[model samples]
Target: LLSDGRAQGYVLNDDIFVFLGRGKIAGLPVMVWILILTAVAVHILLKYTDIGRNLYAIGGNDTAARLAGININKYLIAVYALIGTVA
Candidate 1:
């Protein structure tokens, strides 16, 4: 599809030139900045946020987390929403 230009109007292609400018950063495409920023944000969230801690706890042991007073259902819903948004 990319070879045929079918995906040309997609979000990345649509804004790549505008958002990334016409230059490279640290020998990588400027678009890589988005990936770096996203990684940093996720790292910070998992390291310092309550929701992130809850998510880790649930992943480690759902039964224990629920018994420990974490709202498993709410966190599951939030996880689903986050997955949907990222998709």
Candidate 2:
């Protein structure tokens, strides 16, 4: 709407509210839904991907993973840094 300039003619309020059962859709509920979906997506990726498996292995046994030719501690720090960035 804003890109098309329709929004420029209107004065929009910046308040957020949560509505019950059959009320209007508001900003707060929409923001909550977006956060919840993002969390779920990250959880799924961490639990199911090959990188996630390697990460868990590194967490469980750094020395063994190093022997297996994995850069154990470096990747661990990388993963932590990535999570920090996302947060």
Candidate 3:
């Protein structure tokens, strides 16, 4: 998106603490929607995707997954790189 200049206004300008404290539920403030959406998406992906299965297999045992033709190292590195970028 950035490469094509499509993310120009897709920026989070608010402070984290303000967003956290200002977010609300019924009669109380909280940041639950983000967590709930994340949980649902993870559940759906893990239960219904091959990539999720491959990830679980790699996590269980890299050597066994490799013997079964799973590219454990590539997935691990990709996951790490994603985390690095997000951080």
> Evaluated with TM-score, which candidate comes out highest?
1
TM-score of each: 0.66, 0.55, 0.61
Regions more than 4 Å wrong, model 3: 1-21, 25-30, 82-87
Better of 1 and 2 by TM-score: 1
Give the per-residue lDDT of model 3 (tens digit) for 1-87. Answer: 556965455356677767776867775557576667667877887789997899899889889999999988788898789557644
What alpha-carbon RMSD in Å does predicted model 1 have with respect to the real structure?
Answer: 5.8
The list of candidate 1 runs beyond 4 A from truth reads 1-23
On residues 1-87, what C-alpha lDDT tens digit does candidate 1 reach at each position? Answer: 556855444454656566577558888877678678877887888889998899999999999999999999999998799778755
User: Judged by lDDT against the true structure, how good is candidate 2?
Assistant: 0.70
On the 0 to 100 scale, the lDDT of residue 47 in model 2 is 98
lDDT of 2 by residue, 1-87 (tens): 547755444334434333332234455556566667788987887799877777877878878878888877778788889878768
Clashes per prediction? 0, 0, 0
What is the lDDT of every predicted structure here? 0.82, 0.70, 0.77
Write down the RMSD of candidate 2 (Cα, Å).
8.3
Query: Whole-model lDDT for model 3 versus the true structure?
Result: 0.77
Native RMSD of candidate 3 (Å): 7.5
